[model samples]
Target: MSLFILWGAVFFTLALVFYSVGIWNDYCHKQLKKWHITMFGLGVLTDTLGTLLMYLHVGYLIFTAHSISGFLGLFLMMSHFCWAFLAIRNNDLQLLNNFHRFSILVWSFWMISYISGLYLGINGLG
Candidate 1:
């Protein structure tokens, strides 16, 4: 793989790790801990970086269906993270609890984007 794909893959893997851990912790542990916030934040940050690297590698042509889904997924994740952060900052755990329903939706879409990107990468290799 090229360096661009390699680095993008690494960052995207980190993003998945962070997101999975955060979402699992939040759902299973049922806590609004700082670590949860940190994990989710890291997920978003890494995802953004990974996307940026991929975008650069792709020469900024983003008119494909996968690109649209990727953009939507990223936006959803960002919105979810921002909502959670604000809810926590405002001391509204109740609101946060209610808002978690959106988490699953965003995560599902994120996974779709990830899988599609992987398919694209492997197809490129082939």
Candidate 2:
């Protein structure tokens, strides 16, 4: 694998871990915290960086179905993160909990992108 692929793998792995932490914190802990917000932000940022690296490596030809879905997933995750962050900042716990319900869908989309990307990368399809 090339350096870009290797680094992408590393950052995406971190993204997965961070996202998992955020989801777990939200669902299991049932409490919103600064660390949870940080984790979500970090996950999105890392995932974006990793995706950018892959895009750079393959140029426009890398715009596969998986990549498109991955970008959409990243967008939703970021939006959800921002929603939760703002809700917390505005002292709206009810809104925060309401947004927490969206975490499952966020996690699902993220994992779909992750699995699709993994498949593409492993099969040299990207």
Candidate 3:
């Protein structure tokens, strides 16, 4: 495998481990909100598949899917982070109601970058 594929695989594996940690945390903690934690697992699963496909040198499918998924996962994660912080600050859920506003903006930019990267990589332009 090329370096990129190997690196991608490694990265994906790392993400899987991280998400697994989140799952364990959720299971053990029992009281935290769960949407973002679930998102982590789903994200890790998708990304792991994507990275494995990359290792196999499959083009486009893994690249595009991973690109979209990574952005979505991170978007949820960012919202979770913001929510946690805001909850600490205001002791309320009001800020979380609007958390998506910032997450959308960040996700949009990240998606664009991921799409561009996938296009270049899949087209042999990377």
Candidate 4:
């Protein structure tokens, strides 16, 4: 594999770890916290870096299922992060408490994209 692909994979894995920890911790605690928001931000940052690296390696964009899902997942992740920021900023108790449901849904969709990318990568179809 090229160095770009290797580093991209590493960053993507880091994104997964960061995102999972953030979302699952919030879910388990049943509350939104600043730290969780930090994690979500890190997840988005890492994912973006990974995506950029992959794009550089590929030299162009290809509209495939994996790519489409990845874009969607990234969008959802960013939206989730923004929502979390808004909830925290607004300090709405109900919103903070109930945010886990949305977080989990977003996380699930992100996981689907992640897994699909993995499968495609393994099959040399990504």
> For this target, which candidate reaches the highest TM-score against the unseen true structure?
4
TM-score sort, best first: 4, 2, 1, 3
- For candidate 3, what's the RMSD? 9.2
In model 4, which range of ten residues has the least summed lDDT? Answer: 91-100
Candidate 3: clashing pairs of residues? none
Using TM-score as the yardstick, the better of models 1 and 3 is 1
Candidate 3 lDDT, 8-102, residue by residue in tens: 64665555455445544544554335554455545445555555556456544444554565656555555555554555457566655544454
Ranked candidates, highest lDDT first = 4, 2, 1, 3
Q: Give candidate 2's TM-score.
A: 0.92
Cα lDDT tens digits, model 2, 8-87, are: 98999999999999988788877788888999999999998998888777776455678778888989988988987888
Number of the candidate with higher lDDT, 1 or 4: 4
Model 4, which residues run further than 4 Å from truth? none
C-alpha root-mean-square deviation, candidate 4: 1.2
> Residue 72 lDDT in model 2?
88
Give the lowest summed-lDDT range of ten residues in model 3: 23-32
The global Cα lDDT (0 to 1) of model 3 is: 0.53
The root-mean-square deviation over C-alpha atoms between each candidate and the true structure, in angstroms, is: 1.7, 1.4, 9.2, 1.2
lDDT of 4 at 114: 86
lDDT of 1 by residue, 3-122 (tens): 777898899889999997887778776666667778889999999998888878877666787878888988988887887788878988677776656677788899998898899888
